[model samples]
Target: MIGARLREWARRHSDKGRYTPVGIIFHWVMAALVILQLALGWYTTRMYAGGDRLTAYQWHSDLGLLILFLAFLRFAWRMMVPGPINDADKGGWQTNIAYATHVVFYLCFFGLPITGWMMWSALGDGRPLYVAGLVPWPQMPFGGLDPQWQWAILDWAEDLHQMFILILIILIPLHVGAALKHHWWDRDDVLEGMLPDVKDADDHREGLTHKPKRPRSPRVTGAG
Candidate 1:
């Protein structure tokens, strides 16, 4: 009975304009992970000397897999809990662009890792992929393909992976800029909707109304 009530409470909260706690947590966590993954990838490409270079690649692979798993969970959560609604008053083109950007973001979340996995499999180097040097991860089926085809596919996957990464590099800034523009220029609840502690516009207005006002100063009438 208590469990059912708790779930009901959670559902009600998640339906509000602002993001639910779970959603907020997932958003920030994924943002940090993606940034880290980008850094690792960039560094690994530049460094080509020692065992440390190999270690960097391993870390990048493990992190990419972890991100893919989290992306799946985030997608499931999004399906279960509808995100905050957009400003109904906004222009149609703006809204459509926002939605399209989100679709691309989701695609990158899934595509990048899958391409990376395919590239790894096509290498067919016979080395096990260990997650953080702990558990062995199975390679994709392409590892069994003939050498020429595997290398060709590997080149293709690498190109796709790089393309997706570049797309993310461009999109992330635009996404952030749009949110900030909404919050600062438009003075709307768009950005706050994703934040956990900040109140939405309606709640903020409500808070202002309920807040106790300071007593007014007495006016002097002696001159009159």
Candidate 2:
């Protein structure tokens, strides 16, 4: 019964070419965090080996774990509530490619973090890992292996992490460009669907257009 109600609520918003508020929040919050994570990762790699570098790495890891957790929740929510069928959803090769891009994005979202976690675990330095510096996160069971095996796992995970990072670096701009195309060239609500509902002056003016204007008051000529 509860599931049906939730579906109905989400459907109402989707039918109007908009995502539910929850969906919008998830999309934007994750986007900001992912962008920050990318920048931080790049900056951290350039830092010299020292205490600061270690601290930067910890921040990077924490952000990764948070992103991983949020991605899981976002995926579950997406499964439960279908996205809106905007103008962008029209049948074509572009639409197909867009869907494929989203699949790749989700893969990166999960893949990058898991590989990073593995890399941390394989280091075998007994350093603690935490998710967003709050919840304690467990490492993969890599301590039982031989030193050579641990090194092998570390190298493997690092390679996978780099691969996922490269993929994301390439995809981010393309995704933004596509969204801009949908919004500007296509003049559709596809991009707007994910944006927050804000009543700006333009929207207020547009709303007034549909309402009856008040009659002007009769002017008195006695003063003249």
Q: Name the best candidate (by lDDT).
A: 2
- Look at candidate 1 and tell me the lDDT of residue 141: 82
**Candidate 1, poorest ten consecutive residues by summed lDDT:** 206-215
Error of 2 at 74 (Å): 0.6
In the range 133-212, model 2's lDDT, one tens digit per residue, is 99999978998899999999999999999999899899889999999987766666788788876656544564332222
Residue 120, model 1: lDDT of: 84
Which segments of model 2 are wrong by more than 4 Å? 199-224
TM-scores of all candidate predictions against the true structure: 0.81, 0.88
Q: Which candidate is the best by TM-score?
A: 2
Clashes of each: 0, 0
10 residues in a row with least lDDT, candidate 2: 206-215
